[model samples]
Target: FFFIMNLQQITREKHTYMLQTGDLRQELKKQEGYVEEQRESLFSRLVELEQSAADYCEQIGNFHTNCLQTVSSMKQNRESATENATKYQQTVEDLEKWLSS
Candidate 1:
C-alpha cells in the first residue's frame, strides 16, 4: 500500500511539472512574438530615415548647383557692365575734345 501511494504521488508531481512547463512555453512564445514586432517596426523606421536623408542630400546638391549658376551669371553681368562703362567714358572724352576745339 505504501508503494502504491508513492507511485501515485510521483505521477501527480510529473503532471504538475508538465503543466508548469507548458505555461512557460506559452510565455516564451508570446515574448518572441513581441520582439519580432519591435524589430520590424524599428527596421521600417530605419528605412524611412534613410530615405529622408537621401532626399535631403539631393536637395542640397540641387541648391549647390543653383548657387554656382547664379554666381557665374553675376560674374558675367559685372564684366559686361565694366566694359560698357569704359566705352561710355571714352565717348565722353571724345565729345569734350571736340567741344574744346
Candidate 2:
C-alpha cells in the first residue's frame, strides 16, 4: 500500500550533510569543545558511580559483622541456659535424697 511505496521513495533520496570549506575551521573548533565537555561529564559520572559502589560495599560489610555478632550472642545465651538447667536438676536430686533419709 502507501506505506510500502513511501518506504521505497524515502530510500531513493541521498542523505547529505555539507560542511563548507570556509566553515571547516569553525566546525572543528566546535567539535573539539563538544568532545571536551563530553569527557568532563563522563569523568564526573564515573567518579559518582565509584563512590556509590564504595558506600554500598561499606554498608554490606557492616551488616555482615552485625549478623555474626548476633549469632555468637545467641550461642552464648543457649550455653548459659543449658548450664543453669543442669545445676537446678542436681539441687533438686540432693533435696529429695535428704528428705528420704
Candidate 3:
C-alpha cells in the first residue's frame, strides 16, 4: 500500500509539472507575438524615416544646383559689365585726344 501511494504521488507530481510547462509555453508564445509586433512597427518607422531623408537629400541637391546656376549668371553679368566699362573708357580717351589736337 505504501508503494502504491508512492507511485500515485509521483504521478501527481508529473501531472503538475506538465501543467506548469504548458502554462509557461503559452506565456512565451504571447511574449514572442508582442515582440514581433514591436519589431514590425519599428521597421515601418525606419522605412518612413529613410524616405523622408531621401526627399530632403533630393531637395538639397536641387537647391545646390540652383545656387550654382545663379552664381554663374552673376559672374557672366559682371564680365559683361567690365567689358562695357573698358570700351567706354577707350572712347572717352580718344575723344580727349581729338579735342587736344
- Kindly list the per-residue Cα lDDT of model 2 for residues 33-98, writing each as its tens digit: 999999999999999999999999999999999999999999999999999999999999999999
Give the runs in model 3 whose Cα sits over 4 Å from its true position: 91-101
lDDT of 2 at 58: 100
Candidate 3 per-residue lDDT over residues 1-101, each given as its tens digit: 99999999999999999999999999999999999999999999999999999999999999999999999999999999999999999999999999999
Candidate 3 TM-score versus the reference: 0.74
| TM-score against truth, every candidate | 0.78, 0.64, 0.74
lDDT of 1 by residue, 1-101 (tens): 99999999999999999999999999999999999999999999999999999999999999999999999999999999999999999999999999999
lDDT minimum window of 10 residues, candidate 1: 12-21
Q: What is the lDDT of candidate 1?
A: 0.99
The backbone clash count of each candidate, in order, is: 0, 0, 0
Instruction: RMSD for all candidates, in order, please.
Output: 2.2, 12.3, 2.4
Predicted structure 1, TM vs. truth: 0.78
**TM-score pick, better of 1 and 3:** 1
lDDT minimum window of 10 residues, candidate 3: 12-21
TM-score of decoy 2: 0.64
